[model samples]
Target: MSSRSILLTGASGFLGSVLLRRLSTLEGNSVVAAYRSGKDEGDCASGVLSLGPIDGNTDWSDAWARPVNLVIHAAARVHVMSESEGDPLAAFRKVNVDGTLNLARQAANAGVKRFIFISSIKVNGESTPLGKPYTADDTPAPLDPYGISKHEAEQGLLALAVATGMEVVIIRPVLIYGPGVKANMRSMMWWLCRGVPLPLGAIDNRRSLVAVDNLVDLILTCLEHPAAANQVFLAGDGEDVSTTGLLRRMGASLGHPARLLKVPSGLLQQVAGWAGKEAVAQRLLGTLQVDIEKNRRLLGWSPPVTLNQGLLSTARHFLESDQT
Candidate 1:
């Protein structure tokens, strides 16, 4: 591969940071990382560019000073556990939808060959019935504000691609786990480390997840592959795991076996509903698997790292970081 000039957004985020580091170390990749913090004075020691807060009005003149051949947009208003905004949908649309289209329009005008958008499986729906997995061909049915925003952004990007002739690649990945992971995944690790007995053994809901390494690999593939242009793909590890399976595996990786007490799924759901935590319970006891056959058929890609390998890496990082 010849030297390719690539610009990446969300350089400071969990997924973006990993992708930035990987791109920076690869040979023949002239990578420029774009972040949303204006506090940093000029370019940093690592050559990351600060674009301030990303929104519809954010400027990208500095990034376009040099020719950028490709763009990987991984930044967005991610889902929050405690949303404080008065209008949650409007808030998400401001960043995920508006901010994304703003960047895409500029990228098209600047003659960028490809723009890769990192989307979420929520676009398909919240949960799936047994034996049914979400595929790229299915009609989008985003339920929440965040998923709606991403779906709208995808539609806008595809329309822009048709009008401006700039190729667009959309990837919808399920729950991603790896080193430096936070939120529920990290919480699970913490509980396991403390040897807390969780009443989640009887829950038998299948879920799909992607490793950071596997997702990054797919992103790199979409960056240049002719087949990836103007296409949407679902990404996963191909192997589905239940809630109990996930906890047990994570616990094993952390050197602490999960102590799960078998509890009826119905009782857990009912109790969670009464406490206004139905969403959280559904996540734990819901089936949300994705089919990644498109990725394999089109790009000939499969998750290079297995689920166990990814979990082990996350556990090792958690241990090292916790001790420090």
Candidate 2:
């Protein structure tokens, strides 16, 4: 493959930051780090072209005046506490739907070869029922505002591709984790670091998680892989781990024994709902597993980093950040 100019949205975010670093080290690749605010000077690499703030007001045609061979649409209104409190549907649509459509239209006009969308597995559903996992062929039935927005974005992108003869690739990853992770995963890491005992040892719900590196590798593969075009893939580490198992592994990575006690799931759910953390509880204790056989067979991609290695790397990052 020849050198490609790739525009990466959300370059300062957790996943984007990791992708930016990886892209910086790759040969024959130029990156444009699109931010929704001021440039992150500390995280910007030598080859990264920093462009600030791309919202509804920003003229994308002008912003994307330069030739961009590929676009990885990673920027979106992520699901968080502050976001969920507001009109979540509208808020998510503003960025995940509108922003994505704007960029795809501009990319199409610019004759960009491929548009890679970083969607969430929540587009399928929140949880997988017993004895079944979600596959790419399954119809999307998003359960929340965030998931709905991503599904809408996927539809828009696919429509644009069909109309313009462009290629679109959608990657729905489940619970991505690694260095610089935030939200509940970060909280979990913090608790484990402090050796705080958790009452989640009894939960046997299985969830699929993908490492940052694995996701990045898949993104790169989709950039050039012919089979990836006009395809949707569910990606993960191919190993489902329960909440308790994950905690134990995390403790092992941090060089500490797992500090967890058996707690009834129903009681925990009630307490979480009382505390206005029902969503958090569901995610932490939910059984959302994804089947990655399609991605494996289609792209021939497997997670490069194992669960243990990924956990250790994340633990090391927390340690380093704490010291600094």
Candidate 3:
């Protein structure tokens, strides 16, 4: 964490962009921005490099402009709602697994001290029984292409760490939400802001979520903490909220009523099955909590932002963005 040069991948992405800004502003930290496509006009990094279409064969010769102290690999083939690929697992492996190993090997060769991988909670299976939250020690049971790819990448990174002595820190975060969040979290916010009546009021299941800022804080901690090396840490806000509670909080933050109907969870699941939206229903009603006790005990780290604060920030951003 001293005066060191850091190379950051996916610098223009949602979470990555916020990390880029924060890393760039820190005194004595020189940040190199790496993106896959067009240049990020708002990038404040000292160095910018384009890594077009990451895969097994990406040429990363330009990433090492200086002696890099760390590499935060945030780029990957993320999960999509409607996958267009003919072979989704193969496609994900090419990028998330192969692309990650390719970069890590190169970073090790270049004498990079540490490599931080942003993994997902999906690596620990889909859902947990209400109170039995997933721990970092849980057996990995990735069900989808994206999660499998991440699990493979993590295994590869650990092997590379042993072989090359480059510290590997893997972080599995659950449902990260904050300003500029997209996908389902954003969609939920949109529904709340519009006062749409949702049938999720009766959901009593627990879901753990981490704010983007909180995840970034943990990443920064891992970058320097000695106890973080070669360790897998689960990240969350440390507060589990039911779907109904989440909607209500978001509604309050957005200055709107959730307007949620007290529909029974069983009936909703049945209806979702009939509509071929069982996957969506499971996410809305099922339990997917992660235990962050390892994070607290090892790194003395707790989420810097509370759930309410995070939701309020996200809601304010949504309102401001909608106006513009």
Separately for all candidates shown, the number of backbone clashes (residues 3 or more apart, or on different chains) is: 0, 0, 0
Report lDDT (Cα) of residue 279, candidate 1.
Answer: 88
**Sliding window of 10 residues with minimal summed lDDT for model 2:** 41-50
Query: Poorest 10 consecutive residues of model 3 by lDDT?
Result: 35-44
Runs off by more than 4 Å, candidate 2: 42-53, 82-85
Q: For model 2, how does the per-residue alpha-carbon lDDT over 32-112 read when each residue is reduced to its tens digit?
A: 777755657435443444554554554665446667889898988887754535577987888888888888888888889
How many steric overlaps does candidate 1 have? 0
**Clash pairs of candidate 2?**
none
When 2 and 3 are scored with lDDT, the better candidate is 3
Q: On residues 211-249, what C-alpha lDDT tens digit does candidate 3 reach at each position?
A: 999999999899889999999999999999999999999
Candidates ranked by TM-score, best first?
3, 1, 2
In order of lDDT, best first, we have: 3, 1, 2
Model 3 clash tally, residue pairs: 0
Better of 1 and 3 by TM-score: 3
Distance (Å) between predicted and true CA of 117, model 1?
Answer: 0.3
Per-residue lDDT for 1 in model 1? 81
Q: Estimate each model's TM-score.
A: 0.97, 0.94, 0.98
